[model samples]
Target: MAQLIDLKTFTDKRGNLTVIEKVVPFDIKRIFYIYGVDESKRGGHRHKQTIQAAICIQGSCRIYNNNGSSEAYFELNRPDKCLLIQPEDWHTMDQFTPDAILMVLASEYFDANDYIFEPYSAV
Candidate 1:
């Protein structure tokens, strides 16, 4: 089972910033963003070894994730809250606002062969 990481969100008169430096509980190796998708569009894929933590920095979106036998839905609307994604879990991102900015912190660097683009028929 994958764990959910709750990051600290600091606010001030100026603004706010949430930092997740190295040596934190979860090991982060890569950072990426998904943006500019059309309405109702979705990203369907899963990683073999990459664990991800995603945040909605600009707008709102929903994530549907399933771990073979169990499933979960996460509503990402705040920049401070992040959803931790486990390896080998099927995931789809949808219901995104027009200006949605989904930022992800990955546990491993990019490897094209590590991804499973097809859904598991047995699940």
Candidate 2:
């Protein structure tokens, strides 16, 4: 299953400042961002050992997650909305707004063997 975490934000006349602190269960080892996607979806697979937290820092996107027994859909429309995806959760991201910038924080370094391309049923 995937969990949604709201990041802490501080607002003032100057602006708003959001922070990513101790909420994530693992230490982040890789950071990436997705943008400029038009009519196409992303993330069709799940990891074998990595955990990821995704945040739409600019616009909005929808995430569909399936973990063998259950399924869930998450709309990340705010910068403070963080979706934590576990290793077993097979997820796909789509319906991205033009300005959307989806940032992902991963718990493990890049390893081809860590990725499982097949869905839960095939795996």
Candidate 3:
């Protein structure tokens, strides 16, 4: 199952900075981003080995994830909030605002074999 986590934020007049280090669930290896997304579009798959932490760096979006037996919906609105997705969790990201930008930190490099295409049942 995946969990929504509050990232550590540092601020002192130089704006706020969000940090997710090795102390988090997994060590980051691959960094990718998605933006200019349409509200009607969605991410429609899951991973087999890659662990992911998704953050909405620009605007708000909702992630629909299913953990085999159950499902849940998580909102990514703040830059300091991260949603950790495990290998078996089937997920789809949709309901994106006009200016939404999503940043993902992965535990491994891109490997096509690690991907799983599964239909999600939102809860």
How much is 71 displaced in model 3, in angstroms? 0.3
lDDT, candidates in the order shown: 0.80, 0.95, 0.86
User: lDDT value for candidate 3?
Assistant: 0.86
After aligning candidate 3 to the native by TM-score, how far in Å is the CA of 89 from where it should be?
0.7
lDDT of 3 by residue, 1-123 (tens): 889888889998889987776545777899998888875757678888988999999999999889787888999999999899998888899988889999999999999899889665454
* Number of colliding residue pairs in model 1: 0
Clash statistics: count for each candidate: 0, 0, 0
Residue ranges of candidate 3 with Cα displaced over 4 Å: 120-123
Cα-based lDDT at residue 48, candidate 2? 91
**Ranking under TM-score, best-scoring first?**
2, 3, 1
Best by lDDT: 2
lDDT of 2 by residue, 1-123 (tens): 999999999999999999999999999999999999998989999989999999999999999999888898999999999999999999999999999999999999999999887887742
What's the TM-score of every candidate structure? 0.85, 0.96, 0.89
Candidate 1: misplaced stretches above 4 Å?
A: 1-4, 22-25, 121-123
Q: Model 2: residues >4 Å from true position, as ranges? A: none
Estimate the TM-score for candidate 3: 0.89
lDDT of 1 by residue, 28-64 (tens): 7889998876776575888888888888888989998
List pairs with backbone clashes in candidate 2: none
